[model samples]
Target: MHAWIIWLPVCEAGRTFGMDSLGGWMFWIVCVCFSVWENAALKVNMRESSLEVVRGDSVILPCSFYTSSRLSTLNIIWTLARSSSPETPIQVIVYDYGQVIEDPSLIGRVAFTGLPLSADIILNYTRLSDAGTYRCMVNNLPEKADPGIGELELSVLEPPSLPDCKWDGDINLGGSVRLSCSVAEGVPTPDIRWEKVNPEEIPLPINMEGDFSGSVQIVNVSSQTSGLYRCSATNIL
Candidate 1:
């Protein structure tokens, strides 16, 4: 009868464990297994789940994790999806395991501020495309259930643009006339209004092409309507 003996390394303080007597290949295999077990016991932490920001600004996505055991190699992975579904294609933002790899999708615009425990990411010069949901996942298998999320809704707001005023018909007695107003560009689509320059009971407003253009029909044109007309364009931020 033959007896075989095996030497196993002891892992304490919740850190990856290996033996110096063994070669590097054997050390890594043991390390991976310890990592998987430790990850299962980890707990996740999150600060904020929703955020709102304006265009051309900066925003932060917060996520965090804690474990009693120490990890020799920690991987902080951030992915983007339309919602909180795992089926969606993940846009990798920051991946740190043994090496640090930055996804091209970030394009130098995304930065990782949370170090070691936190996986928060900051986006600079935000645009309309940035509006959506994101998920933060850790390499903690078995323990990894639902990932932390950061959902942001971006609004692009700008003041009303240059306005144009026109009339439906010429000024005449006992004739119907409509004042049309419009603007070239507006963020929330400007609201057009018509007011008598001198101020009087003008006809009720009727929108033409959306609220960008509006007109009011004067049933009976008279000298009282002879006042100059002013058109103003305003938008909701």
Candidate 2:
């Protein structure tokens, strides 16, 4: 007797495992030896080094500084450098001599929520493109102190909007059956895969008649391919 399996993706976890629409961003800041760079009396106080946020939402990257005495002039600069091209850092915003200069590329998208003495920045309406590393540096020219540089990482995520699995044609022994799966939406890219629940009979994965993802062809079916066929959608945020 020939065998074939049918997979059904009927788990709620697959729908909403890591992402829940209302995303949670874990904000963190990696200290670049604040105590050593600046005077022990004056340093930067960062709350978090990493954060996770949902797409289409605004997140406040928490950051502040500690100062011992007042300074004449302060220079604050915020920069972002994507992993793809780390050498060239994009100047997001800058504050100097009581004057503010925001990069045209991020005119309305970025803002300096905190004062010059204590630097804090807020990113508005973040998307997958905004996911990258951020740096905040302050230079108290009068004090001649080392620049206080803090690093923060941001991750944007979105749940798979629509996921489905369907059979191409009749599932017959010695014939061919194609299963194609796909998802409607996923940020930072979504992964789609096919699986068979029952292990007693396993079918071979072949190149089916589809040029898209979540597509696999099983040729020369035997009694082994008679089980549950399932498709799962998820983003590795």
TM-score of each: 0.60, 0.63
Give per-residue CA lDDT, model 1, range 106-190, as digits (tens). 6777877857657777878766555556667665433443443334333444567788877787568888887777777666667
Stretches off by above 4 angstroms in model 2 are 1-42, 161-173, 182-212, 221-230, 235-237
Measured on C-alpha atoms, candidate 1 has an lDDT of 0.65
Give a tens-digit lDDT track for model 2, residues 48-110: 898988987888877677654565577778888866577788888888878888889777877
- lDDT value, candidate 2, whole model: 0.68
| Worst lDDT 10-window in candidate 2 | 21-30
- Runs off by more than 4 Å, candidate 1: 1-40, 69-73, 79-92, 98-105, 141-143, 146-167, 182-192, 200-204, 211-213, 233-236
Per-model C-alpha lDDT, please?
0.65, 0.68
